[model samples]
Target: LGITFDNKLHLSGHINNITYKAFRTLNAIKRKFRHQDNDTFLTLYKAKIRPTLQCASPVWTPHLKNQ
Candidate 1:
C-alpha cells in the first residue's frame, strides 16, 4: 500500500499484489491437475484465492456508502 504526503491511502497497489499472488496460487493448482471439474476449481478458488481477497477487509472497508 502507498501513503501519500497528504495522508491519502492508495490501496490499488496492495490489491494488485494480492491478486498476483492469488493468481500464482491458482496457476500452481492448475498445474497440479491435468483435468478437473468445475466444482474442484471452485473449491480451490474458495480455499485459496478467496481467503487472500477477503482477508483484512475491515481495515480497508469504507464505512460510508459513497466511498
Candidate 2:
C-alpha cells in the first residue's frame, strides 16, 4: 500500500495478519528506506501504512529501550 500528500510518497510493504514480518520491517526504526528509490514516502513510521479496499490494518512496531 501507499500514501501520498503534497507530492510526498509513503510506501508500505505487504500486510497480512498471519505474516507481519513484511509490515514489521517497515515499522522498524533502524530500517531505513531509500527515498531516492521510485517506491514511495520514504515512510519511516508505522501508522503510515494505509488500508486497502481489500482488507488490512496497520500494526505498531515494538520499540527498543535505547534510542
Candidate 3:
C-alpha cells in the first residue's frame, strides 16, 4: 500500500497523492492521444486514470464531515 499517514491518521495526504497521480496520468493521456476518438480516450482513461483515483478507497474513506 502506498497510502501515507500522519500522526493524526488524516487522509488528506493520501487523497492529495492519488489526485496528483491521476492528474498526471490524465495529462499524459491527453498529450499522447490528442487526436484519438472519444471511445479511445475513454478507454485509456478507464484503464489508466480511474484506478489511481479509486485505489484503496474503502480502507481510507473519510468518516468525519470535515475530512
- Among these predicted structures, which one has the highest TM-score? 3
Taking all chains together, the TM-score of candidate 2 against the true structure is 0.21
Q: Write the per-residue lDDT of candidate 2 for residues 15-49, one digit (tens) a residue.
A: 23423643665555345654434334444332343
lDDT-based ranking: 3, 1, 2
Candidate 3: list runs displaced more than 4 Å: 62-67
TM-score of 3: 0.87
User: Please, what is the whole-model Cα lDDT of each candidate in the order they appear?
Assistant: 0.70, 0.36, 0.87
* Winner of 1 and 2 under TM-score: 1
Question: Considering summed lDDT, which 10 consecutive residues are worst modelled in model 2?
Answer: 3-12
Please say which candidate is ahead in TM-score: 1 or 3. 3
lDDT of 1 at 42: 94
- Model 2, residue 19: distance off in Å is 2.1
Error of 2 at 52 (Å): 20
Winner on lDDT between 1 and 3 is 3
